[model samples]
Target: MIFSEEILKWYRENKRQLPWRDTRDPYKVWISEIILQQTRVAQGMPYYQRFVAQYPTVSDMARAREEEVLKLWQGLGYYSRARNMHATAKTVVSKLNGKFPETYEGLLKLKGIGDYTASAIASFCFDELQPVVDGNVYRLLSRYFGIDLAINSTAGIKQFKELAKKVMSTTNIRDYNQGIMEFGAIQCAPRKPYCLHCPLNKSCVALATNRIAELPVKLKKSKVKLKHFNYLVVVDANGQTILEQRKGKGIWQNLYQFPLLETKEEMAAISLGQLKDLGLGDHPSILLYNERPMVHKLSHQHLYTKFWILRTDKVVAKAIPWEKLPDFPVPVLIADFIKRFKF
Candidate 1:
């Protein structure tokens, strides 16, 4: 198809020579793809280099402690991806004998390897001839072909996947997939794409019909949940404090944070009386570290957080000393708090 032809030709001269693109190894491709899932190229590049440098191979990651993995991935939000990637690495080393599955379907058996990731690894490394479809691909296909379906809807997703497969290049599938995605990322961008210079501009239905801004439709996002967190910075004369690992199946699972007391609404005033929720029976003293609550916004939740300093002569068990605070991987919110905090 002319669409496929033009995209590949454009990709040949215009594609950025990213570090991951230089290597034929699936390891780099896998890591880079996962990192870029939620992060832009420039921001994710350093992280990719650091992470791979730390754990150079699947065995290296599988054998390393989970805390170490979380530590390297500390600043990157969406901690679950790190956890899942770690788990998948262990599985890959143990069950698959330290080699990644070659086929698209085989890669999906590994944790966190969904359609997009599997397709990426399969096509880029193994030449499986599958297309990787993410938001960029969705925007590209939606604009060039003038698909107005909501990219998030079930029907829209199915149609887009089929269309991506239909339009993918059969001979040079690696460059073909890369070209389309690069084209989408750089040329057919979400905001103010350079339509005049776009190679696909003449054939793009959205450009032709003046629908570039509205072509890739999406449904409204779910209401952002507002949550309040009161972190107790308990100390007992010694420069030591308590840190608890988050338990459960969520983004910050296995990560550490201070003693957290969650309330339905923002507390009018955090009192020493509120120490009971933290299982502390009437702490001797309390002080609000930050007079104003800091708001940390996530994809679907907004956390209004406040820190309270609790002073007590009584010893608290399992308290990590001030010097050891950096050892554990806490959420970015907590990490930021630590940096600004004196102790």
Candidate 2:
């Protein structure tokens, strides 16, 4: 199709020189695709480089500790992706004999490998005829062809996948897939796209119908629930602070944070009296109090956090030397607090 040919031509002349695109290694491609799922290219590039350097092979990642893997992925949100990626690597080594699945269906069987990721790895690494249907592809196809179905809907996803397959090049699968994604990212961007000089402007239905902003319709996101976090930065006379690893299947799982006290609403004051109520101890002095709460927003949760420094003369249990705080992996909010307070 002309659409495919034009996009491929544009990609050849204008695509970014990404490290992942330089190799046909399925492992590297898989890593890049996973990192870039909810992350921008610029943001995910360094993480991709770090993963490639730390775990040069799937066996390397399989042998590494989950804590070490989570540490490397500290600032990157969506910790589950890292955990799943680690699990998938182990599966590749133990179950698949250190080799990634060669087919789209086989790749999808691995942990965290969805249709889009499977298609990307299969086409880019194995030159398989699988079309990737990510947000970029959805936007490109919807706008260019004037498809109005919600990209998040069940029917919309199926329709887009079928259309993507139809337009995808059978022989030049890699370039065609890359071209469509890149074109959507840089050319037909969501905001203020350069439509005047677009290669497919003449054939774009959205442009012709004066509905460039309306073509790629998406369902409204659900309301983000608000939560209050009261972090007890407990410190002893020897400059030791207590940090607990987050457990359970919630946000920031497996990451370190201060002893937390979650409340339905913001606490007016976390005083010495409150410490006794919380069963931590009695008569501890409030060393540092952040009157202003820091607002940390996640995809589905809005955390209103306040850090209270509780100082005591006696040694507190589970306390680590303050200087060694950087050794552990923490969520971005905690990491930023440490950086700002020079902890």
What would the TM-scores of all predictions be? 0.96, 0.96
Candidate 1: residue 32 Cα off by (Å): 1.2
Q: Which runs in model 1 stand beyond 4 Å of their true positions? A: 271-273, 276-283
Q: lDDT by residue for model 1 over 144-175, one digit each (tens)?
A: 89989899999999999999999888999999
Q: Taking the candidates one at a time, how many backbone clashes does each contain?
A: 0, 0
- For candidate 2, which ten residues in a row score worst on lDDT? 271-280
**In terms of TM-score, how similar is model 1 to the real structure?**
0.96
lDDT of 2 by residue, 34-99 (tens): 899878999999999999999999999999999899999988888899999999999999989999
Error of 2 at 67 (Å): 0.9
At residue 303, candidate 2 shows an lDDT of 94
Candidates in order have lDDT scores of: 0.88, 0.89
